[model samples]
Target: MSSNLPKNFPGRPASAPTPSEVPAPAPSAALPKNFTPEMARAAAALQAGAATAAGQAPSSGAAAAEQPAAQARGQAAMPGGPEVTRGEIADHFAQRIVRMVDAHRGDSSRPRLYAIEFPFTDFEFDVAYALAGRLGATLSASDAAVDDDEPARPLVMLDRVLNNPQQFERIVRHINHGQDVQLVCTRAWQLPQSVADLVDATLTIPRFDAPRFAAACVDFYELGAPPALGADADWVPNVVPRDFLLNSQVARSDIVSAVRQSVERRLRRYATDDALDLADLAGMDEAHDWARALIDEVALARSGAISWDDVGGRVILLGARGVGKTTLARAIARAAHLRYVEASASDWAPPQNEPQLGWMRMNAAFQEAMAAAPALFFVDDVDAFSIAPWAGMLPAFLEQLKGLSADDRVVLIAGAQSAEHVRFELHRRGALETTLTMPAPNSQALAKMYSVLLRGSGSTLAQADLEHIGLLSLGMTGHEVELIVRRALRRARKDGGRDVSKEDLAQAIIEQRVGPESQDRRRLMAADELRNTAYHEAGHAILELMRTRGARLRYASIIPRENGSLGFVLPGVDESRNSVTRNDIVEMVRVALAGRAAEEVFSGPEGTTSGCSNDLQQATAYLRYLMTRSGFHGLLSLDRSFEDSPELRERAESMLQAEYAHVLGLLQRHRPLLDSVAKLLIERQEVSGDELTRVVDAYRSSHPLV
Candidate 1:
């Protein structure tokens, strides 16, 4: 027995009744504000039960409540005189509750407000159910109604504060109304300061010992033998459910097999044989290394070499959607032999106009994760939850995370779009410390991914061919790569179920990464329309060659595209330069409008076609970016629609006009070179790479930038 009691508690009187002498209160008798005769009797009953379990006499302390001799210890005797066991946990916790009640009996003004932190809900339930029965208390949620005249009993608040802190305010109201209540909770971190002050103290139920747990199971289930556990076992009494032990087909002699069957049934959805191992994942080497360290720590914990608290697996996964964040998280869980539980940001979202529901759902998730320890708790789109510090329910979310992080058996993995968008405090120590970004896999990594997906599919490709296909699908995500492979497989099926060839894969890539092939549409165009398309593309190509030093013209096509382009100029961007300067943006805007400029320069303003509509829109976008994001208009850049501000809109339009005129004049000055490129494009449907580069180089050699 221990006491962290306040100084004002009075000493126990010598005349107080012993364990067997306390009397039950009358139905009409007014109950004391804090201490009730029923509670004292209940405490005595628990003490007597504990003493009997230990084969000793009950101490001369609180008096027992009236009950059958067999039921006093939560047991029941059959008609033939055989006694049913009530389990060790009930007896063990009974003694602890007796000491707690005795240590605090002198306090007469406040309720018996105590918090009990347990590892999982089953343990919490076992302790709570037994404690409530012994104390004659009602087991209720925070919202359950309380009768004022009932005997004082511990009001067990299971995961209430963490699930919804506002529920505590209701509790405060109950206490303020002078109700005889005792508060017991699983968490105190989310309790409001007012309620926290009223709480007497908190205690933790230690992890159950294997022998005690097995003994309880054997006695409860009447099994032929006890289930075996490792030397460093962390098993709980309810890991194998009562119903399972009673009804399962596994032989009673093989208790271990029954336990395994029950666990697998419970976790059938999470741990599957087909789930990829951490080693099988590709294109995420950094995440692979991170998971390797975590897996090793999990192994160490299982081996009893280290505690789960020492495992550093709490991390936030940052990446674009469809970049395999969820897949990678699942793979890690599989690798670590953890139960997988997933909740997205939307899962925690409150109903529209019902803000209180937010924390309610958030707490529910944390509660579920806690109940499933040695599990992976993954929350996708965490940015929506922790977008900013002042966001509603973010504090409660953090509090729940803090409580979860303190638990050694569960690993927290949060998925988000970007690390910067999430609150920095969320990434601080004791929270989700590691931030792993799953960027789009590069060409080489994509090549490996392709090879993996194509294996056993009867699709064979040379290494060079795979790399070439990977290069062609450069900007696609891993999901996109998989989609293309599936499409390729389908394509092969249409062609008599033949093995997927390089041409099939390439076509699939072109369909997804590029727009639909438009060769038939291009063939339908008039020669005059083809010539006009050539001139428009030539306009963009020549200006790009002249205006930007880093921009390389990959190709220019006079063929119509499925995306409504009559012809287009594709430029290869500089991979090394991550950001563009203001000057670079200016040149980009000019190149975007050059197609329209070339039309007027060659065929006069009246002859310019609506084919320039796309060009005008592209140029307008660039000009808006300069005004709103690049601070071209002012020192304070506002990332908003230019239409929101009249002045900003007018400024953008003026910049677009100025750039258009500038490119028009430049095109006019280089009329002869533009004519040469247009003529070449008119002869061949496309001009690209070294061929296009040489034509521009020859012109630049003779006519250099001033």
Candidate 2:
């Protein structure tokens, strides 16, 4: 056991308690009349430390020479000088702690065990007597060097003890047995895992941040507010006089601003240019609508117009890649005037070489973000890191989101390419209740978006023209739409000037879908082979233009290109309304076999080239969906495991062959229309959906359907 007396307290001997009229330390700067406990401790510590330094100056050796200058700056000439004075403040602190601790435990004779895990620099082990006094115990109130001993009764000191587990384990064991001692520690993570349940509760004292720093400085210095801090971590005032932080005069607003600046500097944050307005987000109706609500709600809550429980919370936006989900999230945060931070997926699931380091960095980022609450965290592609191979680290991430979601200030918006594919338990109702799938832009929305994108670039294209472009861009993303305008401008620039023609934009959409001709090998096909490719592609165009069945064909080109294709066709379909059936499958099979059928009609069996390879694969995939996935053909097997059985392959092959025969007959009957389309393709090399539909519509008006 150690003495609880304030003995050896500089100028005072080891003795019983006495109300020493010790002159309080005069602050270097002006302070307010009223003071918190923290302020009082700081003043007394600085005063006693200064007195001790002045008295010992002659014997202080090298420090003796610096005494005059040190006094001018309000500092002790010797090391750990302020700590000597802090022992004096411990007398008052001890009494207050005992009162609070006893109030919690009632009048019971059993001593209640507790720990004060303060930072190594701010640990006040000397004040253990105040806590131990309720149990008629005593502890030594002394400080000058770091201690790691788990002292009996009142005092048990540890200096960065979490870094030394052996000593920590011993202390934890003692406490877990319901011992009477009150121990002090520094970090919660440092606690022994074996005694986790024994801990009654834990309270976190956050690091010096903007709001608290401002309040502390304002009251401590008797000033209106604190000075603005810069992004530099070392920008704070020197407040080491017994852990009483501020002694300077600055304003509250400046302090908050400085803290905001520091948060951006110390944490992973997005730049200002990344902020988008909610009105600017295009084609993500579900996400966009929800964002408007979030912005409004966040505003109401920030202004105290709404209850705390009504504030925005967790949101998961499930959609395809490049669909503006991340952008939408940023826009909402910007509108709500909240700081935006991104959780890096790559960092979360790091390389196998140093995975532990990666998690540590990720956790640090999360902690820093939490430290600056009332901010928005944008986590893109969460499913990438929150899954099986790396699931061990996922719970920690989820726990963070759960914690933030419950807070009235923080807002979390997470995005994933495929939500159902995400195996994390966050998808459950309680974890992330507001999960929404982003709806792709329809023709109407696409028209509006195109007009908005082109308006800045000086486009006089009418509403009808915008609608036509939208129809062509049926399944394209917003990013792809921007690319269309850029590609159009570049193409127009090559043709004299940047006054882009409608055809140039149309061609841009074509190249965006099919591989650009520049990417193809320079090896040109023979004349006959070129014509064969044209006929194969034109067959697809005729069905798309004249047949009035299946998906609409948006672009067709016979030019050899990258991706191993001599020609490719872009088809348009509304994925949102797609409900595939057996008939749709049969019609698509005929369309898939159309190219081969056209090739056979033009030059017989030998002319039927390998150009139909893609078509066959497409048709077979659809067949599998029909048989196994959709159960369209009465395959009652509810088991979703992929089927590669010989019987299944045979059935698919038989169905494809039947469809191929029917397609051949249809192309033979409509060979002239196919030839006309093929001739046009061989000449122009590419045809837009609108032009194809226009010419075919004229032909159809003259000749009625059979």
Candidate 3:
């Protein structure tokens, strides 16, 4: 081996060889005069291998030299290697010389020579121009000389004609031949296969600084740096230290184990931690008070510096739409000083690279925290994360979480609309450790929510208005309450006052209606519809009063409202345990037909309203149930088939026909009640139960029972 190579040469010996030790070239040698002894040795080995493969013994040194010479000449005549067109040769040689200069001068210095192929393609020109500009070098067309006087700088070939592979191989061969070349093949698509094979390195536009490039390199190579580095002016062997590599692998394994531990610890923590107090998020005083107590219990347990034990377990907050699940989850994270990582179900993707890398990242985040205390990984919209495409990945994620050791001290809090949905997905996988259901705001909470919203807007609302809003928003969530309040506030502001009136709140409530109310309202005209609804309800009340004279009429309104009703009448009655009677069924039928009768009498025969659709359906079903299921029909001789029997059916039909006629007659006779109720509805747009009762009592006193 050569001993006294340049210091820049890597893996070379420091000392020169003695003269006697240096072997002279053999007489049989036929290699290029400039070929190094090492190159000659490599060539000799190749020749020997060729000879053995041909079933012949190793050739003599002289014979081997002759054989390679003949082979090279034969290869030169073959059309296999890179084709060297006149234009390609110039471009290749030029690029070779430029690379030689760049290699020798270092990155900071510009190469002395630059040769560019003429009429460059867009890709070629862009690359060449960028390189020349970067090095502060000049670009010259093919056939152009660098200088007539001094030695020209190496030419850089920007071959725009050769295909990708041809250009790539040509560049590689020139470098192997010891030519200083840097080829830029702009016509890469022309020789895709060849380019794909020989291009060892690629330089994308926008060269970055060392730090970015280093990070990018690490990511691309999927490898880490050595634990230590040695100071040197020249390139060193730079093999990764065996100890460091081994330590990193151990550390990675430890991290994976720690992550598994943390998940388990989190589940246990949430189980014991006090339930989340969501009063502030709820924004209702009563709810706040109630939630505060629960929050305080957790706070007490977590008091005086949080430790692994203080950390809560994984909590899945489940609720309907517009509930405060997300809000509560965030609040918990903020209060507990836990790092929240929010991920939607949709955000979960199939795991790539390794099955455990995602878990590893998550684990790494909390591994350090375990030594100090515990942290929370709040995953939001967890249901979305469990979609079918991500099912395979989800099990691994959940399994990794389940496998987490207790020592890791991390909590997992998930938020979803339905705990059942998540439970269904994870129950089999055993993902859910604890499920907390968030109920909609209660009446008191609803009132308090309205008050809070009003107070924030510097407005004063009467207790009556608050009560009304509360009653209307009974089944609504905290978010719905907030939305209702916000809408009311906006109305108040637009009306040029901070005070929200009862009418304003009611209007806001109507405007914010969802579901059926949000549908088109053009099914029936308003006035005719209101009148019909009032008459129909009046008929029912009047008939009920006639059948059960003691039954008191509480209230009736013909106001067009959401949820597909034109009017409604709630009859006042004493709370009792009494079941239904035949008389009650007949009276109910009369009340149901009151609106249609009133329409027929007041709005004429042509007057009809779509409002009766729901009423008709309900009344028919009730009558049918009573006659058949309740055994109220007189046809005792009939079995279940009585409903299909002509005689039994005829009897039920006659009874219903009479009841319908009676209902219409009652509505027609109590025209005074109809007029009064309609007038009130038009004026108030909404009549309370008390108001309806008072009106009904007045009408009954004036006109007597039908």
Local accuracy of candidate 2 as per-residue lDDT tens digits, 309-329: 576557778888867777777
Across 1-706, the per-residue lDDT of candidate 3 in tens digits comes to 3444433332233442322201111212244423333444334444455567689796554333223222332333223221211212222223333465455557643222122222122234333433332232233223222233321222234543232334444445444544334445422222235544544333222212234333322322233542222232111111111101121223432422332344344434333143333444543343344334434444544453444433445556777767776666556555654434445544555365443334333333333233223345556666764456555446545654564444444566677786545736564434666667777766566777677666656666777768666666556677766677777777888877657776666556555553223244445556655555555565554554455633454344544556656556555443342477776776677666665666677777677666667667667766676777666765453334434677756766687678777766766777777677666665664565556667777777777875
1-706, model 1: which lDDT tens digit per residue? 1132222223222233333322231111121223333343444444456677689986533122212122432233233321222233343454465466657656676654666655444344444544554554444433334444433433445554334554565455545654334444446666666667777666655444577566655654455567677664543432533323333334455554555456556657655355566766777988989888988998898787988778886688899988888888888788888878888765666655555567667766776665556788898877885543226666777787777654447787889996766877777777778888888877787788788888879777899989867666676788888899999999999999999987788668756744766767635677667777888889888877776556566566776667776677767555456788888889889888989888888788887899888778888888888887776657887778876888878888888889889888888888888899999998886676447889989988988743
lDDT of 1 at 498: 94
Quote the positional error of residue 143 for candidate 2 in Å.
Answer: 29
Question: In order, what lDDT does every prediction score?
Answer: 0.65, 0.58, 0.48
lDDT, candidate 1, at 204: 57
lDDT of model 2 at residue 46?
44
What stretches of model 3 exceed 4 Å from their correct place? 1-277, 280-310, 337-341, 346-394, 403-410, 416-430, 514-594, 601-606, 618-662, 683-689, 700-706
> Against the hidden true structure, what lDDT does model 2 obtain?
0.58
- In model 2, which runs have C-alpha deviations exceeding 4 angstroms? 1-204, 207-274, 306-309, 344-346, 350-359, 371-373, 384-386, 405-408, 427-430, 490-501, 519-524, 546-548, 574-577, 627-632, 635-648, 697-706
- Cα error of candidate 2 at position 691, Å: 2.7
